[model samples]
Target chain A: MSQPDPLADFFAADAAPAVDRGFRMAVMEQVARRRLRVELALRSLATLLLFVGVALISPVLQRFAQLLGQDLSQVLLVMLAAGLVAYLGHFWLTRKPVLRLPHLRFF
Target chain B: MSTPPTDAALVAAARSGSDAAFARIVDRYQGPIRTFLRRLGPYTSDADDLAQETFLTGWTELRGLREPARLKSWLFSIAWRKAKGEARTMARNRQRDHDWQEIRPDCETPETERAIALHQALAQLPPDQRAAVSLCLGDGWTHADAAGVLDMPLGTVKSHVLRGRTRLVEILGVDS
Candidate 1:
């Protein structure tokens, strides 16, 4: 006897819809372009930040150290610590939320 | 003859910057993503955009996936979240707030009307419940796989599937 499958209609609706090849190509092209853009932007930003920090911030730090009669090395160390904190804060604020991925043994 | 590489192997290759491997992965999954999106909405452009966005996000984050073999579930999770976010924006613009917009079935033939009704009934379900039903009943995924994709507990996925099925029967005028 052929058994009745009641949920067959629901399953029938799950057929793979027609999607053109251009869709896949568009996705890959965008991903590649984004990877390059992000890499270049990050490189440019880091270079700019490093240049400004060293050229401008160092002289300002030297002035502050001399005026406060503090050791220049100690002032520089504090500035480095502040920079580290800023970098971390930026990362925490900008990081994309990660996906929740876990293996399913049942699959 | 060589056996096909597992998803994990392909993922590892893709992570190493192998575009070919990533392309293979895309070739394997594009249909499911597209079909899932199509079932979720009537607008072809919306489905197409979301499908592409889903893969782009997948490629961006594939390196960080905990389990490579879980690629299908992971991709579905990303798609699910993207679809939900887009739905929120659309609903906001329209000043309406239904999670799943019940699309009136528009098939021409009688044979297809029941199937379209099933799709509409499926869409009428709450988003999470519809996802559970789609992944489990529609796609024939195991409860565990559906749970993984939906990021819900196993029991919850099972419950959603059961309840979703009952609701579909009621909406489609089918006996339990």
Candidate 2:
């Protein structure tokens, strides 16, 4: 076997920087705290958007149903049920666990 | 002596809102993550940025990790994704100059010649084979560890290492 090249070893060793233990710990603590804040902020923004969207669309939907000689309350109920079903479907699709398929053998 | 707390314990604590525990996890794995990024061809500055992004993403998604004991591999997986993402972004932005210059940094005469030769040899190999050699030999990761970190099949990892080593020996004119 040939000897290991010193140049290769040197390049590998010098390629990465020296990490400061204390600074890294501090940065991690900062990131952890920031993550919690970001999560909470996203949740709040999503809730706000949901409320605003419903508020802005409810009256418009009701007026359109009434103009078409349809019962506004019944139309609203159907629409609400459809929206719930769609939302549930989307949630199920997104949150579903990744399933590993069975191995296939070919002779 | 009290046994040191395991990675799972530290990860669990972080999930439950312990900043110090999360910091410990970062301290434990940052070196390996940085080395991995460097091997992927990022210079020090970009490598540091990507490393920081990896940890940030890891911390945000830590709660969703099913197996806390596999934290090291999990962290490496995130780093790999981040590095690839950055590479794509750089390419899209027409920032090839920055990347190429970073990877092929200037060195003194003999060192520069060797570095260029090694870089050329590595570039000729397939990306997976290059990663296998850089991570396993350059970064000092075990074959099994590199396999787990790279999310490759163990057998595939072994083949990549063997093929890559043989190619490097031939390219560098190393005697058998």
Best by DockQ: 1
Off by more than 4 A, model 1: A1-4, A18-20, A46-107, B90-115
Q: What residue runs in model 2 are displaced by over 4 Å at the alpha carbon?
A: A1-8, A15-18, A21-26, A29-33, A39-107, B1-3, B90-124, B170-176
Q: What are the root-mean-square deviations of the candidates from the true structure over C-alphas?
A: 12.2, 13.4
lDDT of 2 by residue, A1-107 (tens): 97775436434534544566754865666685686577677767777998999999999977877787757668778999998788778769887434433322110
Candidate 1 DockQ vs. native? 0.17
CAPRI accuracy category, model 2: incorrect
**lDDT (Cα atoms) of all candidates against the true structure:** 0.75, 0.72
Instruction: Give lDDT tens digits, candidate 2, residues B82-176.
Output: 87677666456446534564464445666555655566566557667877787776767788988987789999999998898788878877663
Angstrom error of the Cα, residue A50, model 1: value is 7.2
TM-score of each: 0.68, 0.61
The complex in candidate 2 yields a DockQ of 0.11
